[model samples]
Target: MSCMQHLVALLALCLSLAAVAASSNHLPGGVNLNERFFNQVRALIKRRMQEKNCARVHCPLSNVHLQPPLVDDEVALQNQRSYDNVPIPAASVPTPVLVENWPTEQHSFGQVTAVSVDPLGNPVIFHRAERYWDVNTFNESNIYYLIEYGPIKEKTIYLLDSKTGAIKSGWGSNMFYMPHGMTIDIHGNYWITDVAMHQAFKFKPFGSKPLLTIGKRFRPGSSVKHLCKPTSIAVATTGEFFIADGYCNSRILKFNAAGKLLRTIPQPPEFLSLQVPHAITLLEHLDLLCIADRENMRVVCPKAGLKSSHGEGEPAATIQEPDLGRVFGVASYGDIVFAVNGPTSMLPVCGFTIDPRSEAIIGHWGDFKNPHSMAVSVNGSALYVTEIGNNHQTNRVWKYVLA
Candidate 1:
């Protein structure tokens, strides 16, 4: 059939589907498939048109204008706009020195998204293989168009020796689309999130099959049973966990041991709404949950056990220092919270050590190009960071030891 015929048929199918949904009142999962469904259909149609135009010109639109052009002065103004009056931290924590010649072998990766140290001190890495998230990656519904791009067949998970950066073992082939956050629980269970899949999975250590999975596969919704682009997972000893429902839904979700939804944790009133709870870490000792609120460019901490009605509560503390600079990931070692931020127009990419109690920036570190997620060692002696790199050119797993 011609393109015009296909478009007409699609529109007719959409109308029929809408009518059926309206008559049923809601979808099978109790999702109100109303205007949102129509919006998704429209977005799909628009994307098809854009792709056709690009094909006609023999140029891919996805390669054009990935980032907005900014002049030096504009970048400087944006970097100084938010925290001009805030005082920079004076006292420095123990400097973290990069371990040279680490990861002993040269291995190529595609957008390493997350890294965590296992109980045996091996750094487990979650990467995207060859898949890349771009403007056309997801539709308005936040569901990845996987039919156009097949699932990655390569193993996306890797375990490396902490001392030598040598591969200990690797698994997770034919699994995961866009690997995001990952964590190893006390019981040796691996918890991971996939933004493209819109779900979180719990796997037995070194096992390929998921022991438990959260969210409907490839379906994005605000309902309790569904998650839109989940970014991070933080699990407790008791098996209770929290997930950062990222990108589209900017909120934190809590679940019980058996993968049952508990409730959505409320963001602080100060943030009328969270832009992106991109990464989250639990401070078990301090009984606090800290999140890297990415677009807000701050770290928000609230009492881990605090409960409120209808997702409303105040944070125990927050860190919004100028040096914080677009936090992408947050990790905690004891009471001190560590955060990594990508570069702005003016500032270079760096990380910060914050005293959560005082909400002060205590220490600073640099030398990262595009740090996505980070993890501190069990003994607090070393730090593991995964960088997505620019255009997936420098996908690397970095290790730093306290000096």
Candidate 2:
């Protein structure tokens, strides 16, 4: 027999022997030793299988190019401690004013999950249509199990004119289970994440079918072939992309243009363990990859191409304000970073701009019911925010322009 078959047979023999022994001898306190032993063996086998699968699927990196340091070593040390003493910019910072009666037609939506400005400056929205995410949307394994009224046929992707907000085109019918995040790469390709599908997709401009798909269908795993409820994706000009495997696996995974596994971004020692990396935004000008560490209520900015011997590196900067609430999304225009947060006991629902270098809160804007995701215009003249809406009703996307 082959090596794998022989190993499997050996494991089966050991399990059988354990079962026989456990049935004959009872553990103290009336515990069922057979059940306990079986559960332990099952967990061990599952973990080993996952590791094997990951090793088999992922390609090893022999040499990784690292980006130059964002700052001198001494200055970097100072910035590391800047979080506690960040200077609060004056209130004179400009806050974008909401444009009223926008979209003109006032199209209705179910739950606006994500919004991104395409290369042509048009806003593309990813919504849930008639589907809703609730307590039972995912089972214990983080696999989407709630299918209501069969498959939803509504178009989930909508491309609107940047000026008039009129729908230019729409597609994505009968595809995706639960839409979570969307981003338009520099090349105009759409990178989207589906929490229910546990997958990320890359679609050509106005394309109905995806040109590339990552992760296994309906399977939630941390292996190279599986993603556990991935939340968002950010693509670099070089075609390298980062995916926030948020819901279950709290890690950002990097992949190449052809969808090859690259590496799992290492969490910075200074920051708390990632709870849920809800959104990711790449600041190309600054060579920074920023993440919305949702439950941790912080934005971790790591050097874009920085890698260690193992093809992973620490974050260069972070924004963790007590009053920032739960940061739901992050976007960047030039060196300026923009973040939006849901309401909390200490702060109202608001969006704020930050100076990435100084890690300071520069400006703030508010009045959102539930700001879930956002996108900034290429020229830094406008911002678009998507709201899941209150009570699962009044789902809307709002546009704001810099004054």
The prediction achieving the highest TM-score against the true structure is 2
TM-scores of the candidates are 0.73, 0.75
**CA-lDDT, candidates in order:** 0.75, 0.75
lDDT of 1 by residue, 100-123 (tens): 877788878888999998887778
Which ranges in model 2 have alpha carbons more than 4 Å from their true place?
1-94, 147-150, 267-272, 306-312, 390-393
**How many clashes does the backbone of model 2 have?**
0
lDDT string for model 2 (1-403, tens) is 4323433455566577666667566554665566654564565455445535544664221111122226568865675533323333333244678888887887878799999998878899999988889887888878678755444589888999888789889988888789999999878889989888889999997687789998887888988789999999998888889999998888888888888987777654534378889999987766678889889888888767733332234666787654466889898876678899876542457787876666645555656767899998776778899998634446888899866
Cα lDDT, model 2, residue 35 = 67
Q: How high a TM-score does candidate 2 get?
A: 0.75
Please state the error at residue 205 of candidate 2 in Å.
2.9
